[model samples]
Target: MVATVNEFDQTATNPGQRGPAEHQRREQILRAAGEHFRHYGYRKTTVADLAKAIGLSPAYIYKFFVSKQAIGEAVCALCLGERTGALRKIVEETASPVESIRKIYKSLALSGARLFFEDRKMHDIVTASFEERWGNLEAYNHDLIGIIRRVLIRGRELGEFERKTSLEEACRAIQHTMQSFFHPILLEQNLDHLEEDATAVANLVLRSLAP
Candidate 1:
């Protein structure tokens, strides 16, 4: 079974490499639990409620996850994984470097608001995921950076951008400069006009690399 976006329970293994059956089963748990968590808050969303939503026993849920904490982290991973997929697609197929990179940068900054602020249940999941490990955040960050690097290098190849710095330097600089827009806490504090803020920062960075 392919790893569906529904994955809710996991062992912290590479999500891309999880077994199909595991993915399918865990995805069930994730969807139901995620709903419960969002509706009732983490503390209030019990394993029984999660299991009942999916028509499974609480013990069955434990077969796939260690505890409610693991389920919460997996939910966070599921959400982040979606963003990673979106960025990956942008890097792979975008024909216009400037336009696509600007979108990607803006999206990166607005991710927290879209994923967490609008639906705070995801934020609670993230807080839990951060406790024991970065959960999917680390992998998502690594993959996104690689994708951005690819886009930057592609721009240089197409003469859309000047090679002012090494690809490594350029990539890191872009991420670093956009931190104010993308970082969860920072963006959360300045929620209004977030899209505009991110877009402005994105365009500024692109201009800095213009030929």
Candidate 2:
């Protein structure tokens, strides 16, 4: 089942309402948690471990995060939020819809491969998020699909892509086709010749969109 953003957002105070000290404390916790989660793996790390790492008692940690799982969710949200922001920036900078689609696929595959190979330790947290069906995963996908849908609409308006199919269907189908290039769990098995395969898939999707 898909999870909601609230599943992760519930762990922390709303940013707008958070005081200076509260914000600093949360940032400190998240930074320390990220380091521990990357080096020690999320499952092996505990609330007490995090507290000790940051020179705080476990009880103090609990004041900010209710549980270890909540911390994990918050950490996952932070990582996924960075990725989504990067992709959005890519979309904004690229002018052509067709080229934007190509870059998106390339970015997805390259980033996924980086996490799988160079950052396998850090990738564990993301893999757990996928296996456990966390809400942040769905939230990330929703934001990504929205990006693709907007690109598709722009392409159609520019007479660069077919408008026969609805943008919703087109975007969903594109996401389904490109899942292996982006999804962490799925991309692990397709590392060899990843760039070639990603380009081929992107080309195929682009051709299918041709007017």
Q: What overall lDDT, based on C-alpha atoms, would model 1 receive against the true structure?
A: 0.73
lDDT of each: 0.73, 0.80
Clash numbers, per candidate: 0, 0
Q: What is the C-alpha lDDT profile of model 1 across 59-150, one tens digit per residue? A: 67766665676677677778777777887787667788898788787677667777665888776666555554654667766876887788
TM-score of each: 0.77, 0.87
Candidate 1 off by > 4 Å: 1-12, 15-23, 109-111, 127-133
User: Positional deviation of 76 in candidate 1, in angstroms?
Assistant: 1.4
Q: lDDT value for candidate 2?
A: 0.80
